[model samples]
Target: MKNTLLLLFSLFFYTMSLNAQFQKATAPVADKKEHWRNIHDDKVLDNYYWMYDYFGKGPDSTKVVDYLKAENAYLDATMSETKAFQTDLFTEMKARIKEKDESVPVFKNGYYYYSRTEDGKQYYKYCRKKGTLDAKEEILLDVDQLAEGHSYYAATGFEVSEDNKLMAYGVDLVSRRQYIIYVKNLETGEILKDAILNTEGDPCWANDNKTIFYTSKNPVTLLSEKIQRHTLGTEPSTDVLVYEEKDKSNYIGVGKSKNNKYIFIVSNATMSSEWRMIDASKPNDSFRMFQPRMKDVLYDVTPLADKFLIRTNKDGAKNFKLMECPLGKTEAANWKEVIPVRKDVLLQGVEEFKDFIVINERKDGLVKLRIRSLKDKAEHYLDFGEPAYAANFGANPEYNSTNLRYSYTSLTTPSSVYDYQMVTKVKTLKKQQEVLGGYNSTDYVTERLYATAKDGTKVPISLVYKKGIKKDGNAPLLLYGYGSYGASMDASFTSTRLSLLNRGFVYAIAHIRGGQEMGRQWYEDGKLMKKINTFTDFIDCGKFLVAEKYTSTKHLYAMGGSAGGLLMGAVANMAPDLWHGIIAQVPFVDVVNTMLDESIPLTTNEFDEWGNPKNKDAYFYMKSYSPYENVEKKKYPNMLVTTGLHDSQVQYFEPSKWVAKLRDMKTDQNILLLHTNMEYGHGGASGRFDYLKDVALNFAFLFTLEGISK
Candidate 1:
């Protein structure tokens, strides 16, 4: 009898502990408030629209907070089994980082400027040395100290005056990207009383150290609306409004020429651009129009000693071209071709120097640097020797220097900095990323493959995996994509991704349309009326991977954030059986609703990318593919959707509302989870290590689904 009682007690305690660890908690059921949106002769009923009421402090604000908290609680309970695994993953990933790291110093204006991170610190210290690298270091700003108390803090736009006596920087405590400008007396180590609020972070200093030009943003919409000039130690309210952009769709910014001879205010939209310039010596002078905005044409101006270089898509140059215009005759008609547009090559941009120009061009989805001597027009392309890599011009602030600093990296290689002697054609590697716990590029293999799209267009896919992984259709693969805004999703190195690669996971990046990987035309085909192409292209890539025996449908996963999150949602709906799991971070899933609401941040600015839904044709087209709108009583892949409460780019309500609808409509019992960071914004945690926690959770989710605990 005693043995029987002891056995029963042991069993009872074991059951209790298991229940406590993984509780069968009920998922939060959001209250459905009837909300009807009628537009373009179409009416739609939204049940979770109350989520949008949080920012406005409406009656449902408390409900919104409560629902998000409840969802977080549910996620915690559901992922309880992986709590220890998550901590282990975080520590493992963090261990690979070199805690004490410093960036390569770049020479500019008699000072070598660089940033260094201390051990265990989440931010960096901006510093510079006068004359030489061995000179006593002058710490301009200690961001780790500045970000000490705030839960979310960002510092940007560090600019030093010509004399280097003063430094100006921008700070944002709220994480909304609305930065306040502050000046510091570098000699005295005192922060000035000048605080310019609600301005874009970058401050362009005039030749006169006291005057600074900045772009002021609208408080509500957070759009760059006006260029304002501020005199240090003066009241911000009394700052002079240098220029106000009347076009709501255009974004405006203020910048100074690299030679420190001109100050410019540039206004640009999706398809058009205009520039205004004034002499940097004359801060109070009116800016002259360098060029007027034109429809369907985009141009950028780069100043040189004798003339200005114009990079434009004028005359239907879909791949863009470089032209030269005399300083006095700054007009479209006066521009003459310097680098003619090529059918195969896309002239991305040009870096101007005293006697040479380095042209950034792309062909066949790879970057090529073309160096040309300004005196003799002798040009040569630099050899990178990599099949798939990203190389771009790094800080070449000194226009007279023959050495150009650039960064290079690939899917399997660590990011490396190099100084290329443009005249001698010599390249010297300065610094490479230190992946602490020892890493070798030869331990991995990277391949560039092409997948045929529905329209027969070839989409590039960059894949990296452990050296021994076989294409046996049994290994798991995580394919990522972000096909929007002509942003090329290049294959770059991330030390943290080794955690996945080592676990027999094949990681790949689908360079689908909507990105400029192939060229500008690739982006054009994936946006607006052709927006459906982006979705189809992603599906085709996944299908190709499965067809090629890289992975089976049961072990394939997909991940994307923001606009890419929209891609996740679209794929989950369009091809539900293709992916075993999906992770959408702060996804823009509510397309028609978000685009129709002009009051939302970035809505007006995205009119060209996502057509204005007020139009009848665009509304129906976007509605047809909108993730939230197309939610049906069907099975969806296991999903983990994340969002930030104060997300300014893609509002938190989007993902919140999306998860609620999926919970209500999705038929599968697959694990569907939402994790909302109540204190942060669209960018998640602001710390260097804090963001890794999020990554750990994501990785843990993937691992748990694969039945791998550690």
Candidate 2:
């Protein structure tokens, strides 16, 4: 009897211990179905490959959704302590925003167009007034009504007819970016029955005002391949296909010239571009090729009074230059230099007026606009006061107007619109965003600094902090980056970011490689086999900031989305101890898998950006740094991974699989969360105020790690 009692006691204690462990479980251990993939004599065993099952389609999708749900629940339960704090943060952030606001009205054609938000509305009400600003407003569409029944909503590509009676718009509710074009009679206030399905959302209005041209995408790959012509009130099924881009690697788009003289069909690849032109006055006419596609030559045509201006990289002009050719004689040999190529400056684009032309250029990773007189070819640049700022052309629909409308912003200033007279050089500030609850730009300090990379490249960093914040090493710092597609990360002000700054946090933007911050060569040096530089540059920036006493590893945090999320993952594996916490939004971590699958969106067109995995060398190189394949038994930072079920660009599975892999391998006990928004996409929440909820949740995660309850 004594032996039996002893055995029973031992069993009961064992059961109690198991229950305790279960109650304190940190994360779900994903089941492993290890699958072998051998490419170019290299091999990988993907354990969570089954997680790629389509969200709601396949038989295994239920398992996938359940697993994701469990992760969300785990995140919720773990962070339950911060729920109240999250609400407070959201409230504070929203309070700083002006509830009732209207955008600066832009005069175009015969009307002044603008959008306004009501005190409690989730979407904008698009309106316009004819003849004068004092005229009665014509509400074209109340977007909130269109967005009422959908969990996700977007209304874009609003183009008013030349006669100013009808407006064409595109609507997307699924978040997959497949938009349906709809036309409305602005004068009659009637929503037309005509609809065009599955377009790229941008439609070009012909001079006749009765027809529009739009590009369509392939169903599987989602590549814009065909341009179709649609006449108002006609069946979309009977629309004419104007042009088709036969090459899968090339993308096609249609637009009207600024002067509305020509409708252009632009076909562009990684290294080349071709333009087709048709007279806007003749909607029934076929397009004629302006210049045949050439290897290593990319150019865009802008129709001027009697000639066409071309921005081209011809004759080894890595940083493009401006060239001009007679309208009827647009051959390679007929091209004449208008603005000669400068090695140190990148000529971004040109905006033409009747008497002058505004050149958008970048120098030292900063944007400036140069106005040149068309009569005498004299030029001057617009003077922006700050060290790091962005100034670019806004809506200038009138080709003959002397006043140029542009937007300017910096790390310390709110977004401001200005009208600059090209001849007088007078800049009139039209409007500056209003930050409610008594905000002041003077309370912030902005600085521009550089971090040297391993290869002697100086990467720029933009820093902004609240006044009176110490530069001590103990201050918390948030480093943000996104370096891909030659997209530059500008130093723009954000009212939401004030939350972090007010909390004594320093925010820095690392203008790493893979971005065109320093021009084309900068982007070239960070792609393909040299792609590792992007990761190294970010890592070096973090280390340099720490060495400079900006912040230490204890309080350092990193954030990025999409391609930059890939950067976060690589750095986490390469330097796990460097960050205390990391936030990855809609990360594209499964590079090798996604690139190998041609059916995926953006894969076929981005072969030059990220090498084709079919090639032996490319496969091995990509496999070397692909985040999911690189995760090993290591200690990682506290991480919050977010994704949207309807994401069109970076599929939710990439991040889902990555988090599962990290959870299974990482040895750290730090928090790991996965928040899948079932209704949103690559860009988070659609509504202006609802998106702050995400920012609040992220802030709450960081605060929770620091034991901050407020």
Candidate 3:
């Protein structure tokens, strides 16, 4: 016992020595400007606004790049002490993955399609077999070959023609989300001469198979604003503009119906949607409007036998409901209710087939699939035994089949895919993701808990930890939250997270407002003017857990990315002393400024999700909560901020300027580091295993603060 105490004492001294050495190195400094602006009779100063460079290679980009490089160097110098440990973490996490695994084949038309990863490849190979999975594998496109010479690569909108002879795909070589559409003659193994640039990545195929409808992005704002028609043999410059969205706030998209009977163009904003339909057989015919756009009336059209199924939010159905209309009369007044809305149920979406209809609904913050037999109209819900889990429809391309494919997972369960007979109600497990190393689902435990907010509202929290770990406040905990855009962060299992659980770390997600966890009202109560509730809810969750002996402030850590990154920034400012460290990834910190600038990608389209800062009330309200605008000269916890230079969603300038200002005004000597990925964008690295390197880096930062460095 004496020797053990001496060993721990010696290790603590060594760690302290490393911290002292790191603190001596000079931190990167940024030049500040006295730029003042007036808005709604208010004056504000933005010192680091000079970092705004959309292209990342503008005339002033040199200084911007240099400052970023210096920050990267400082991070390297400070984190150098954990270089070996980070590498080991990366290797450890990567080993849990099955390197040569293949996804379960999804059957479409005459082929069974799937993607396979090679033992050492960085990208996947899309392959298919005709008739059955036992047939010879036919490679559609080797993404590994396409990504060979690029630093970043992503392929999207992978769709096959109705005839199964052509593959339409989109590629983005630079980590920006701008994808260029391409068509390949699969039989000849040759890419065609057609190439359309800057698309939203979803291609709609006409029944003729030679004509395609795709949405194009605006050059300046990067919003999907135009729908274009391209024939297989036509010149790229001669593509016809079929439709265009004049409203800047509306995003446009095109899709083929599930039955491949009709093509559609949908224009949607936050609370409104308008759809136009085209007969699939007549490729040259113009599309006709199914419904006119109405404010606060959202709906989606699904092609049915003699009528159209519309999932709409009309008639005060805040949680949405299903309605039907004649094929020739799709106007709102002519619609008939197919499924009534329930206050406690959130009707997410629907999948139509000749023999069955699947409704995806959320209740009590959990997802379930309701399968109804079209013949007898008998409905049944799939049972997931866990208190919290995710279940939804998989790719069921055929409209005449009785077998339904679905996926299910939870915090402790591996992703499992099954094919169930809707009529017989028999389910067969097709595949479950394999973890290479020895793993057991029963080894960990997940629980559902609620934390009461200041307003007396109960916020749900999903927690997972190693089995048999004592809830004694001594264990380190990582809390995560992202509450924006009505996006629900479901309880999904991940193999990489096992690394933390095995090392005595508890992970929890605070499902706060601004997400659709508890239905439409949950999201309604936490956005725009009520955005503070999302942040405060997360804070309350942390306080509740600590008070309950789950963890204390000394060992608590916070993490989030993008809008959630905004959450991290808010919590840090609101309760700086509550966390030992915080990691913000590609955070949208400059909310007020970013919203005021309409040229940015998020400004025009998300004006409803966020408010239009041009309004005086919104200007002052957002100004009060914007993270970058509210940074004060006070002590803060250790922070590690990361962003990519080529980010298309939240610009790199946001986080870059944020960290610079924090360094200038922060009073604490606590370690603050910024990492700028020069080769990636908003989503980070494109390689299969390369993104794990960042995860390992983040874990290393947390482990170091807890003095767990090896």
Candidate 1 C-alpha error for residue 267, in Å: 1.1
Lowest-sum lDDT 10-residue window in model 2? 15-24
Models ranked on lDDT: 1, 3, 2
Q: Which 10 consecutive positions of candidate 1 have the poorest summed lDDT?
A: 14-23
Q: RMSD in Å for candidate 1, one decimal?
A: 5.3
lDDT of 2 by residue, 1-710 (tens): 99999999995674343223122436777888877888777788888888778742666787888888888888787777677888999999999888889998888898899999988778999999988999999899999787887778899999988888888999988888888999999878888887888998998889898999999988768899899999988899999999999887788899888888999999998778999999999988999989999998999998889899999998899989999999999988899998888888988999988888889999999998989898998888888989998778898989989999999999888899999988788989999988888888899889999999998989999999988877789888999998887889999988889888888889999999999999988888888888899999999999999999999997899999999999999889888899988999899899999999888787888888889999988888888889998999989988999998878899888999999999888897677889998788988878889999999999887766554556
Predicted model with the maximum lDDT: 1
> Once superposed on the true structure, which residue ranges of model 2 sit more than 4 Å away at CA?
1-25
> RMSD per prediction, one decimal?
5.3, 5.9, 3.3
Give candidate 3's error at residue 550 in angstroms.
Answer: 0.7
Those runs of model 3 whose alpha carbons end farther than 4 Å from true positions after fitting are: 1-24, 54-59
Better of 1 and 3 by lDDT: 1
lDDT of 3 by residue, 1-710 (tens): 99999999996785474354343568989998677868898999998878884353455778898899999999998888788989999999899888898998888898999999999899999999999888999999899999988989899888998899999999988877888899999999999988989887787788888998899888778989899999989987799999989999888899988888888989998889999988888879999999999889999998878788899999799999999988899899999998999999999999899877899999999997898876787888988789978788888888878888999988888899999888788999999988878999889889999999999999999999998888889889999999998999889989989988888899999999999999999998889889999999999999999998889887889999999999999998999989978999999999999998888885799888889999998888888888899899999888999999888888889899989989999998788989999989899999989999999989988888877775
